[model samples]
Target: MTSKKSDLEAAIDAAARILDSATTIGTLGHIGPDGDAIGSSWGVALSAHKAGKTAVASFGEPFVIPRHFEFLNQEVVVPAKEFPEGLDVVVSCDSASAERLGSLAGAATSAKKIVVIDHHVTNTGFGDVAVVAADASSTAELAYRVLQRLGWPIDADVATCLWTGVVSDTGRFQYSNTSPETLRVAAELLEYGVASDVVGQELYERAPFGYFGVVSAVLGRAELDADLQLVSTALFQEDLDSADITYEETDGLIDLVRLADESDVALLMKSLEPGSVMASLRSRGTIDVAAIAREFGGGGHHNASGFSFDGVPEDALAAVKAELAKQRR
Candidate 1:
């Protein structure tokens, strides 16, 4: 019996056998299902299906990513609303806990085996077998590695998913996570036939009308507390309705702020519902925002974290400001 503490390379070999023998495999991504999460989930699902195994993706929540992601769906992802049964294995990607599994918890728990793969710093590895890499820029990177080990070449489609995961998590290779190894992995992915042009166009070149408005509004209203080395921005419910976007669209907004020469931390908040606002935090150097997020009922990596609450954008912004203020003093 292979112990759970086995290395990633060993785990991938073991996982391939488990996947090949499984009658059915269910793949899942974390809540909000951003580029990295969706890309990784789809990568594993597609690779498994191509290998003659039944595979499907679950949103793990009520979240719906950009319609552009329909490219990755390829008629395979089962809506979170639908419940499928008799799964031989559940492959959880980029998720630290089952709570992140949301609507599909029942199926995951009932599966004969659960394969956990992720790169989050806060991951607790709640699965029968875990394959995690703290040094990985994104789970898509891990998926790419796993598929290569399974003797599968990175087809154009797989390359697209890998690229999305890399661009999304690396803030388009701008974040500190984009190590030489990250670029090396990316370079190999391109060899597998990933198109960089299409990726750049969809993610960077084009944007909905309201996207510009929201971006403009956010920049105009964005505040910087240089003394505290923090920058913050917020949006209201009107902003959400004006543009057909999800949390994924706002994924790297914090990183945008962190790009500043002096900013050590970045904060982005948007109205979720009547009074609820969603918060995403990003850090550049040594500061940890995970503790800050947990103080408000959320959790994530040291430099990246999230939270939600009922309140006006400014009010919640004030609270976060106070939290950092305490740190400054």
Candidate 2:
């Protein structure tokens, strides 16, 4: 009797075959690509190049690479407009849904084959070959395994990209998602000459002068609802404008807000534009923040999740608080 392959294993096998036969490939990450998204997409693209395939990697509109990830090689990355049309294969990295692909969804949909590599629990499985592993620490880990399975060479630069993804998504291995396997994969990548110190310094240690001002402003108004075990804060456009900061620079602010020992949950709401808000949610261990995000047409892991709102920050906060109230009752 033959044993059935796991969903992830079967998906990887199918993706390898598709990639092996393809002459041209396009890779994309989600909009406002995070370290995991950027690293996974580029890692696969670099690996594809090593295998002697023509590959392009890109993300959706507002295609700015965040300041922290500027060290990554952009050899294969191109603007969405520059991404070749009618590619033989399209691979999406770390995007939970087709909608998250933003302007590039059409490219994936039109491709002869689509491969989805991700670790998000809420992934919609939107590809011909879906390697979705909710248990994996980061999509980069899954990407590493897929490349290894395909017998692709992971050079030092490739390892650096993958290392960034693992470190970022795992919160420097402090998040609950970190497992022995996660550390093992990271160790292997380090063996490939990944500059761990550079990654750590760029990602966590260094920030622009303006960043301190923005942090001060956001922290000043932080609220703690001890009864609900919730700590929350809101950042308006003025906060960024006054500090000469961009919305992207506020990514690490939630980590500070979530440090309140009295609260098990933390929420950060930021103004994207007038009447538009984006939120980041974090939980220490008690709450399933991802379920809350899903209620608002968003999704993520159990501890960290987010959503966008069409209303003012106050209304968004009210809605999230209401949901938390319901959960407690």
Off by over 4 Å in 2: 1-5
Model 2 vs. true fold: TM: 0.97
User: How displaced is residue 301 in candidate 1, in Å?
Assistant: 2.9
Model 1, 1-329: lDDT tens per residue?
12343577788877777776787888888877878888998888877777777788877667576755665535457778764766899998888778777778777888999888888766777888777877788888888877877775457787788788888888789777888989998998788777788787776666556666667667777888888888888866666567766445654455566667778888888776778888988876567788778778777777888888678778888888778777666
Kindly give the stretch of ten consecutive residues in candidate 2 with the minimal lDDT sum: 1-10
Q: What is the TM-score of each candidate against the true structure?
A: 0.88, 0.97
lDDT of each: 0.77, 0.89
> Per-residue error at 13 for model 2, in Å?
0.9
